[model samples]
Target: MDEQIITGATAAEITASVRTLHERGALRPGDALPPVRELAALLGVNRNTAVAAYRLLAQAGVVVARGRAGTVIAGHEAVAQEGYAPDSVLRDIGTGNPDPRLIPDPTTALARATGRPVLYGEPVIDPALEDRALAWVRDDLPGRDLRITVTSGAVDAVERLLAQALLRDDAVALEDPCFLASIHTVRLGGYRAVPVPVDSEGMTVDGLRAALDDGVRAIICTPRAQNPTGATLSPRRAADLRALLAEHPYVLVIEDDHFSMLSQRPYETLIGPEHRRFALVRSVSKFLGPDMCLAIAATDPETAERLALRLSPGTTWVSHLLQRLVLAQLTDGTVLHAIAAAGRHYAERNAAFAAHLTERGLPTEAEDGLNLWVALPVAAKTVAERLVLRGWLARTGDEFVLSERSAPSHHLRLTVHDLTDEETARLIDDLAESTR
Candidate 1:
């Protein structure tokens, strides 16, 4: 065991020591530290000091406390990120955004939105748009009791949902290596985020149950193309999660299927057929363009009514014009075709990049969605530094971490697959060089 991880006389120092080691790649995920008694002896502190340090780390989702197994870094939890430097000379592979070039041109849709102005006291939802939203969302929702509510975007719907269902400091379960926007929303809303680790098969049952046991009032999940990780919940995993959640049926479950039309993955759901208090949100941002700013939120009636209170009168109904534009685009054959083509483009390019990396012994696979989640042998921060020297800007794994901000992560969620074959090859070689 590394003795230096236990040097601090104070609780904060002990925790910070482990953080420093993890950040610079000295400590690794799932690696165990000394036992509490051993750590206390090494630091010449009270046993409570070691216990407090480990408790703090565990609370932050940085470490797990297993009886007899000691404390180990918590792995596979998700979080959000920051963008690349604005004026950098490097080719940025860091931005997690969908390429604007692929966003369907909305000029045609906007111009074709011939709907008349909407007035107050008019039905909150435009009759035609609501019908369209209902049709588009109904198949994915498991229950007939689901109602439609429109929000500016998926983020808006999420914020409204949590605001309606939870009080300040209420615990909310979030996927580890989580969606950045959800993390931001949860924090800004003053709710507590309990990180639930997500694997390739999607959110781990153990993580969700663990959070639920902690009395989390709400859960926000991405059923497909999970942000940063590109994890799509498998059918079996979805079923298992649903079964576990069945015991806690009234806890609010919100599914943000952000990549609906553009996603290649199957629509597996955790809002089981009988599960009450659920919301399924699908946004048009990834396909129709972020400028569209339209999303259809399907939820149980009570949740919908609570969410609707926030969207009343003139305060915040989605613009009638924007709604019509989204409808026009969704209905237009050409626009739908463009969205399909863009989806194929993202998958193919990501697959190509993943394949090249694997050939070079990096062992990557572009499973789904826009970005390729690439694992590196070296710490991601170290690899990112080398990429910067080589004129490439990549997002380090730490950028998306929620609690364990400096965990020694060896992955990069890169959106650089649009690079030329030569550029991809050179970048892969540079990555290997940096690790070596």
Candidate 2:
């Protein structure tokens, strides 16, 4: 790593030089960057200018700061996402997906989804869908300055909301044992994640207060049916969080209610009536199927305006057909009944499985989500390894943790709602054996 390769008079120029050097193979990943003072002296610039240059590069995902180790070149790595293993023979019980059998058939709604052709300059959201969504969303988010915007899904909406409000390197408070997509999005965007611990009552008050004290610009919370852990926010817990957040009135709050329709628990929120900034996102993927690729965001007027800037008029807006399809299914009597039945089915299956674990001396509770978070007597990694040997693939709770200082997770998140009675019994037996 020759200091001579880095030559520039200004911060932008220095950033460009490093990018060019990396492109030309002169600089590689893990290469050390010169310290701020040394680089400043070499370029005859102030130390602040040198620091700014490095910050720019870090924001671009081209470099990472390592404190005493100084700055180093960084390489992009593919993030793990939620889905089935492409060609694996093992039964995957870890993928956080809805049961396909429970998802209502979309074919019947396709014809109803068809309508008059929409032009480029027309409104982005379908009139019918918007009308239905407003009524439905209003029930949950009552009495606030609200506006509805659509995106590909809950993940897309969160990304857009963060992009609209945050700068690179800004801190965002995320739930520990977070949703996979949130972890991936924060890492890729080059933003810092502050871990806020979640218990049976969702985000803890002290954890959120700490994140706020750390000067997080934003917070992403799952109010109901939190992923991986299946934690829901109790009314008292929500009130405590809202009271704490009231002090930092301007910190943006984004609540993701991904299991809106399928959740058996009541919906509780972190946003206060007088809170200045927020977004509440609900996606149809859970009940309508993932391929539908549509979600509605109810956000503050200013936030909605800022988010709209990222979505171009004609090309980037969510498809009208998808919105119509969701609206049709939502309004249909038969589809609503089916969705309600599916919710009960998931609760019943998880309870049965939890009882099985309890009978075997491993105390467990059936939480209110599609997955069961099981605590093993031993390390979850040991059990996962044993499960793999027995033709079962499970996701360990360690993958969702935000900080290394947190205790080693002895938990596994299992999606076993779709499993038959015989299959469930076999899995319970295998889990018991694995712990031994």
Candidate 3:
């Protein structure tokens, strides 16, 4: 609270001073920061200098602007993450993972993946993998003259693409009910997230218009198997979005087709033929197993060059062995058949579960992707609590929503495809009773 404690002449210096203060316990969470004008006067600096300092602190999440209340220190908030609880005994049905049984065995492919050692100056992409990947993604892409770059996974690709193109505090359009990793990525990068609501047909046009109007520098889209909601972008909806995006041709568009291999729905691209500045990322995690962390990024020439800057030879390039393995499995007839069967298995299980809910007077639909989005008669939180008592752990739809106005979601995203018939029946009965 001492005016004497705050001392700095420049924005970066002021930010560092505040950080040191916080580290020393002088500026605790919820403590109000000095007003910009007052701080400028005290520190004998220009008003813009103080404003820039505050902006830096806000972007780092050390302080939050509270309108009339002014700015206050922000304590760490709980971030939603993927996978299961570390020590929970509850049967987790909300993990949102692919069924392990369906993932093809990698033993044979691993053995064949090894070859002569790649030197530091060799091309980053394996020649065979690059060739196969190009053919694989070419048909679905609307844009031409695309270049490919590989990354660890979809999350890594997105982070690099955004970092290359955006500055801290730049606005980015993200789906309201979004993928957990995507949400975390934007927040950690200090980017302002503009919420774009998603419907059964994928990201709504109105929501996107609002984000664009807000001046978002970049937009992240999921073309199919949109997480948490299992919504696929219809051809008509994709056309509509392309028309809207056509005007803003320079805004960086990053489309993550994370479930491309397993999606039952047709790929509908938002990128128009003439539109520039875009990247399409496809990860092998869903079908090839999550441990094999490799993804292919196809982008415009300029974007590709920007992204390449982050990847240094031998230091940051994706593992050549892993890339070869993925390509081999992808081209194998047996692996292809297994992937197809796995897709059907997920679809059938979700449909069966939806049918059960319909029979119980709670209508639900089996959409594409590994999970089923079910609407509950009561609050999803209440149902989840009841399910917890009945030995089930469920993910509430609220966790995926980006807007506070969309809180207290009544829907629950359930991944019951891997459950046995007995377990499925038990979950259905428990869900019905919980809703009541």
Candidate 4:
């Protein structure tokens, strides 16, 4: 609070002084830095020098400019999925992955890979793969001049989309109880994640609008089979979101349909034709397997062009071999049927598990995806500890939150569809007893 504390003649010195303040615990997260003009006068520097110092701090993620609210210390730390504890003798059900047995074998498709080795300066996307992927997304994509760009996975596509357009400290609206990867990606990029609460009908309109008022320049949403919470955007909800987003057409909307082939619900898009900037991404991990590491990003040609800079040939394009394999599996009728069957399997099993819990008077619901989002009667971590004693591993929902500082909620995202009859009964019994 002392004027003599901030001693600096140039931008570098001013930035260093702020960092020292934070390091010494004098300035904590959410604490506002001095105004540009005030700091300039105090440090005997011009206003431009103070502004440049703030910009440096913003880009480095030391502070965030909150429009008229001035700048505040950057406060987000990305949350990582607490993978199952190693060496624990428990039936692990915490991993939010697909049942491996359902994933189609790529061996038959691999032999179909017959082509010349792609060289530098050649086109980045495999032609057949691009064509097929485009057809897959065309039905739901809004723009007439939509373009497709393939990336290693959905996370890669989202990362590239944001990095190409946004600056550090720019606000991004994210679903609360969001996907782990999306949370990690946005926060690690130094963007503030404005939490939008998601209900059974998907992201709440009020939540989205509140975030927009906070000056969020970007939005990341899951239209169907949302992770951590098995919420899907209904037709009415999608229409409301599209209408609200139309007012801010320039806000970049990136929809991650990561459960495309395995989602029980039909593809309902949020991007309106009139909306200028938006993207739709579908990754093959759920259906084919996570190891495939491939996804298709459909966006306006301008965004596609900008995203291409990082995917240019000879630097970071997806491999032609992987493209061929994905294309082969997609076009084959047999594989298509297999994919459908897998979708049904996940839906039926998840529904059954949710039904069992509900029957036991422990509320649970799973509209789609590979997991069930249950409303626990007790703190999920405490229930998780009880499960551990019963030789079961559970994933608590608080780990998926945007702010870990908030009060822990009574929810657990469980991936127990793989359990057998007795295992399910025993786990349900244990869960019921633990709640009592």
Taking every candidate in turn, the Cα RMSD to the unseen true structure, in Å, is: 8.9, 1.9, 2.1, 3.4
- Where does candidate 1 clash, by residue pair? 77-176, 77-177, 78-176, 78-177, 78-178, 79-177, 79-178, 80-180
Candidate achieving higher lDDT, 3 or 4 = 3
Q: Give the TM-score (vs. native) of candidate 1.
A: 0.80
Q: Answer with 1 or 2, whichever has the higher TM-score.
A: 2
Q: Write the per-residue lDDT of candidate 2 for residues 67-135, one digit (tens) a residue.
A: 687898986756667878778899999988889999999889989989888888888888788777788
Counted clashes in each candidate structure: 8, 0, 0, 0
- Model 3 residue 107 lDDT? 86
For 1-436, candidate 4 gives per-residue lDDT tens digits of: 5546777899999899889988898888888777888988877889999999999998888898876888988776436653455787788887888888888898899999767889999999988888898888887763467899999999999999999989887889999888999888987898878999999999999999999999999999999999889899999999999899989999999999999987889888779888888889999988998899999999988899899998979789999999999999999999999999988988888888888889999877768888888898788889988888888888888878774445677888888877898998898899898777
Q: Could you tell me which residue pairs clash in candidate 4?
A: none
Best-matching candidate per TM-score? 2
Write candidate 1's Cα lDDT for 1-436 as tens digits: 5686556889999988888787877777888888898889888999999899987776665676655767787566444444556888998887767777888777887787876777886767777888898888787774477789989999999999999998665789999887779988887675778989989999999999899999999999999999888999999999999999999999999999999888988899999888889999999988876767888899999998898889886768998888888888889999889899888889888888888788888899787777888898889989888888998898876766665654588889898746777888788888778867
TM-score of every model? 0.80, 0.95, 0.94, 0.90
Error of 2 at 288 (Å): 1.0
What Cα-based lDDT does every candidate model obtain?
Answer: 0.84, 0.91, 0.91, 0.87
Question: Which ranges of candidate 4 are over 4 A from the true structure?
Answer: 1-6, 10-12, 16-52, 63-78, 82-85, 403-406
Candidates ranked, most accurate by TM-score first:
2, 3, 4, 1
